[model samples]
Target: MDFMDFKNKQTTVVVVGAGFAGAAIAFHLTRLGMERVFVLEREEFPGMHASGKNAAMIRQVVPNKLISDLARGGAAFLRNLPLDWPVETKFEQNGSFFLASKKDSEKIQQDGAYAKQCGTLTEWWPIERITEFIPIIEGSPASGGLWCPTDGVIDIHSLMQGYLKSAAMNGAELKFSNAVKNIVVHHGRVCAVQTESEEIPADIVINAAGAWATELGRLAGSLNVPLTPCSRHLFVTKPLDWIKSKWPIVWDITQEIYFRPESGGLLLCPCDEEVQDPNITKNDPLILNMLAEKISHFYPRLSDLPILRSWSGLRTLTPDRQFLVGWDPCVEGFFWLAGLGGHGVTVSYSVGLLAASLIVEGNKSQSTNQFSPSRFR
Candidate 1:
């Protein structure tokens, strides 16, 4: 296949990974009138990894201001999805509470203020208010919490499919179960992508491979942008009368534990992060013990509850915890939309917008400087 064939008609773009990042980028690229977009997913379907396995929470008041800005923008988009959004999704606006002990209370307050300045509605809730909203934290060690009223949970699967569906409706081609084995680069520029069955000629290749991003970059001979896939577990409890569906998500930042109402019960995470291989994640039996310890020390009221089920997912992180969403300086026409860490679901929309702008306008997109792949080099 001649690269000129597709390149002459349309900018042939191949986006690896059909998770939130890839789906959103494809959605926007097509929305912006780009025609030859191909989304290749190794799995039989999209969001088979972290995108589907998350708690589906839309957290906005993160410690990183840059990520917070994207979170705010993404949350706004989720709250008010465009009139033509392809699928129906329910965004549970029960809000979120980022609790902290006295030592970290000031930081939480400051972060909340920054989110507020960025247009997210945030309030500093006292300990009394926190417990009033969720009685389980009554005797907890939390001094106070940052309450972001707009933060909530959404149906992640529906959201992921919505992006793909919209992109497909606009002309992006989605090829599932096609794992890219190698990227064909010539003259320091991406020319084609070799998958399991065939070689696809392309003008641009996007590395949105989530946990496998670093591996994909290596295939393309792009910058070795240190990305690590870390695994974490989420547990769900049996239905309890005390669990309130309207209760906001409560995350103890200092303790690194968070829980929210789910399916007449609660979804909990001990915030365990362990470096792991790209797609191989297993629940360590010891993490459950760790969670038990944290629960006993923190919220005794919710201790020893019957855990119904649990699952693990990967969150790829950069050393600085900021996202990598720009072009590869070492390899031309190879862009990056990876390293979203744990905030992918919360910030995917705005991240896609930024990535599409950079890909289309190149250096003219001044905002790409902060997240440029060259920064790592």
Candidate 2:
């Protein structure tokens, strides 16, 4: 069928992925009184990719100022979820520690100042103070660390479900196993999308497809946005009695490695970033060994801990490492909300609100200009 045939059927806004971005956008749009909104997911359920596989830490101490602002806003929103929300997204106030060496201590301090300027709760802890919270890092780290007290861990599964549930309650439709195959655009504007079984007529198409965003953009014949998928691995050790259940998430900032207490054991990541296609599968043995060796160097006591399991997920990144949020300058009804990288969960709420604001109201905010897709053009 043609655009006009489908256009007369329904005036719907079809979101192409049901992860944090898609679900959150659907929720916000529905709340704003948009009735014909649909969230499409390729998997049988939501958050099957990065959203479900993230480290689940709500960290506010990021390198970029806009990211820090988004993280701050998202963290606050998670802390104060509505009372009637269906799912209970458990927010563990375990805190986060960004350990830095003497060389990078000054930079961390500068970033901490910026974070404070953004109204986030952050403190600089010396080597002595670091041991109070993270006993394992007594003599390992070179200098001090930045302690973000408001930073915490979140149950990502529940958080995604909460967004989807809230969106469904507000009259949004969710279609699972509907992988969008092609986009039907006419007059340089999005009109509909073709899935496996049906043709979905949409007034606007939001590209929240995570790792597959660029491919979707190509399907729509829009601007070719650069999105790279980097694989990050996570390893969890068998439950150990030595580690406390309340241990804060610890990361050696100079070395891109982090570990957090998980069910009496530890969940660790070597922070390995490899450019790869989006596919969910097993963990790489080399990455596991690398993580173990790195843990041995920094955390000798827990290095030999038996690994209970391991898995890998892709973190979609842009060239500057900032999110590409806005509409495609060349395409009329196509919006860009991809390139979240590792901060998807942390900045999801704010990103969704920003996307909805731009789609529904237009770019009227001062901050919105920085994230426009036209920058690449």
Best by lDDT: 1
- Tens digits of per-residue lDDT for model 1 on 1-377? 11222223278899999999999999989988789999999999999999999999999888888898899899989989999998998899999999999999999899999888877788888889888878898778988988988889999988998999999999999999999999999988899999989999989999999999999999999999999899999999999987889998999999999999999999999999999986565988888898999999998998998999999999999999899988787888888999999999989899999888777765566343698877798
Any runs in candidate 2 off by more than 4 Å, and if so which? Answer: 1-11, 280-282, 363-368
* Stretches of candidate 1 exceeding 4 Å from the true structure: 1-9, 366-368
What would the TM-scores of all predictions be? 0.96, 0.95
RMSD of each: 2.6, 3.2
Query: Worst lDDT window (10 residues) for model 1?
Result: 1-10
RMSD of 2: 3.2
Best by TM-score: 1
Q: In candidate 2, what are the lDDT values of residues 59-117, reduced to their tens digit?
A: 98888888888989999999998788889789998788888889898888888889988
Backbone clashes (count) for model 1: 0
lDDT of model 1 at position 146: 88
